[model samples]
Target: MRNIRFLVVIYLICQNTLFAQNNPFYNQWEPSPKEGAFQMEDYIVWGGSVIKGEDGLYYMFASRWPKHLGMSAWVTNSEIVLAVADKPEGPFSFKKVVLPARGKQYWDGMMTHNPNIHYHDGKYILFYIGLNYEFDQPEKVGATRELYEEAWNHKRIGVAVADSPFGPWKRMDAPILQPRPGKWDGAIISNPAPVIHEDGSVLLIYKSAPVPYPARNQNRTMNFGVATASHYWGPYERKGEDNQIKLLPISSDVEDPYIWYDGSKYHMLAKCMNEAITGESGAGFLASSEDGLVWKTSENPIAYSRNITFSNGEKVNLPKLERPQVLIQNGQPSHVYFACRNPEGQIFNMVRPLRRNQ
Candidate 1:
C-alpha cells in the first residue's frame, strides 16, 4: 500500500506539470505585430503595465505619443492610455486615457509614464513616474543633465488605489517615493515596479542615476536600485542608504527593472545598453538575487531583439526592444513582453514566448 501511494503522488506531479505546459497562453506568446496592431496611425504605444482583471480580461496601461514627435518626445509630451484584449497576446483595443496632462497644478502635471500595476490587500495599486514642470521645461533642462539627474530633481513616483483593476483610482495626494539627500537614488526615483514578499513587506525595484560630474547629458548611466516599505502606501526607505544602493552586479546603463520571485529565488530582467555586445544598441540582460538587495547579472543575455524580428517588418536589430515585462498566470511565468521601437524611435509593446523546452 505504501509503495502504491508513493507512485500515485509521483504520477500526480507529472500530470500537473503536463497540464501547465498545455496551456495555450503558457509558453505560447509571440510578438503580436499584426499590421495596424496599434490603433492610432500617428501614435506609438510604450512603457506598458499588464494585469489580468477579475473580469477575465487583460488590460494594459501604456504611454502613447504622436508618431511625428518621435520617442524622445515621451519625456515632455506623452500621456498614459489604456488598452484591453481578450487574451494576453493581444489584438488589444485602445481604451480611454487613464491620466491626462495635469496642466501644471501638480509636479507630474505635464506627463505621466511608466505604469506598474499590482494587486495588494484586495486593492489594485498603480505605481508610475510623473514628470514635473522642473524637468519638462526647455529653459530648466540644463539644470540637470543626465536622465537620473532629471528624474531625481524633477520626476516623482506616485501611486493610486482602486477597488478593482479597472479603476477610478484614488491617487495619493503626495508622491509615495521621492529622492533623498546623499543617497544613490537621491538624484532620482523613477521606474516603480514592486515585489511583495511572503511576509507582506513590499520591495519596490526602481532605477536611479547619480548626477554626472562634468554635467554632460549623455554621460549619465542608469542602474537598478531598490527600496522597501512595511506597508504598500509607503514612505519607502532605500535599502542601503548608509552604503548606497548597490548596482545590480552588472555594468552601468541598465534600466526598466522588472523583478519577480520564482518559487525559491528572486529574478530580474532589465534593458542594458552594453555597447561591447551589439556595437551600438543594447540587449535584455537577466539577473538573480538570493535576497532582494544583492543582484548578479547572468553571463549571457536572456533575450535580444537584434537576433529576432517581428511579423510587421520591424527588425529587432535597432536600439529597440527594451523595457522587458513578463506575465505570470497562476504563479508561473508564461510570457515575456518587450517595448519594440521603430526606426524613428517610437515604442510599441510586443510579446514573446518563454519556455526552456522551446
Candidate 2:
C-alpha cells in the first residue's frame, strides 16, 4: 500500500510538470538582445513600460536615480524619464524627464518609480508609485534606515495623463490608490498593474502590506489587491474580500506584477519572491484568470529566470531581475522587459523578444 501511494504521488508530480511545460507564454522566450538593453553612464536604470506612439515610434517610461546614491535611494530620489526607439526592441535613447520631483508639499513630490504605460480612449496613461518625506535628498554617502522608513511609508499609487507620450503630463494632486487604515493594505500601496478595456474600464492589481515597512516581521507578508474603475480617471473601488485578490495560490511573495488581456482572459507575470510557487525565488511566475478576481497559477508557472541568454549566444546570471513589463503588439506579447542588477549593484533595463504563435 505504501509503494502504491508513493507511486501515485510521483505520477501526480510528473503530470503537473508536464502541464507546466505546456504553457504557451512560458514556452515562448527568445534570447534577449544585447543592444536591447537601456542603461546610462551615471544612472541606475530600473523597470519600464513601452507603448507604440501614434507617430510610429516606441516610447518607454522608466525609472532612474543617480548611481552615486545607490539603488536603495530609489525610494527618495528616483524620477520617471522617457526613452524612445524606432523599433519595439532597441538601443533606446533618453528623450526627457517626464515626472520629476515637484515639491515635498505634494504626496508624489519626491520620487516617482515603477511606471506602467498604457493607452485608453486616445490618451496616454502612466501609472506609478510615488513618495515624499521630510528629509532632503540624501548625499552619495547613503540614506539611513530611518530615512528609508519615513519615505517608504509615504508611498502611494498615482497616475499621469497626456494626449501623447511626449507629454505635458497632468499629474494628479492626490493619489488614485491609498492604503486602508486597518486592512490588509493598511500600510502602503505600490506597483500598479492595470489592464484597460476598450470601454476604458481598468482592472488594477497592486502590492500592499498589512503593516508599514520596517515594522513587518515573519508573519507579515506583502500581498496583492485588485481594484476596478469604471473610467480610468475616476473613483476606483477595491474588489474581492478585504480587497485581497489571490493571484498566487501558495504564497504572498509575488510582486511587481504586469497584467494584460489577450481578447478573452487576463494574464499576469510577476516576480516570485521565494521558492514556493516557482521553486526558484526571484524568477517570474505566470497566472491567468477568466474573471479578473479569481486568479489561478499557470500549469507551468515559471515565466522567466535570472539566468539570461543573449541573442549572440552568450549567457549571464544576474543577481536581481525584478519589475517585469510585457509589450503587447498586434494582440500578442512581443517583448518582455526587466530591471536587472549585477553583484556590484549596477542596474539597467533589459528586453527579450518572444516567439509569436504562428
Per-residue lDDT of candidate 1, residues 93-138 (tens digit)? 8888887787677767777888887776678778888866644433
Candidate 1: where are CA atoms >4 Å away?
1-32, 36-39, 134-153, 181-183, 198-200, 212-218, 241-249, 275-281, 299-301, 311-316, 344-346, 355-358
**lDDT per residue (tens digit) for residues 48-82 in model 2:** 89998889988999999999887689998999999
Q: Going through the candidates in order, what is the number of backbone clashes in each?
A: 3, 2
C-alpha lDDT score of every prediction, in listed order: 0.66, 0.85
- Badly placed stretches (over 4 Å) of model 2 are 1-22, 217-220
Error of 2 at 321 (Å): 1.0
Worst 10 residues of 2 by lDDT: 16-25
TM-score of candidate 1 on Cα atoms, chains taken together: 0.78
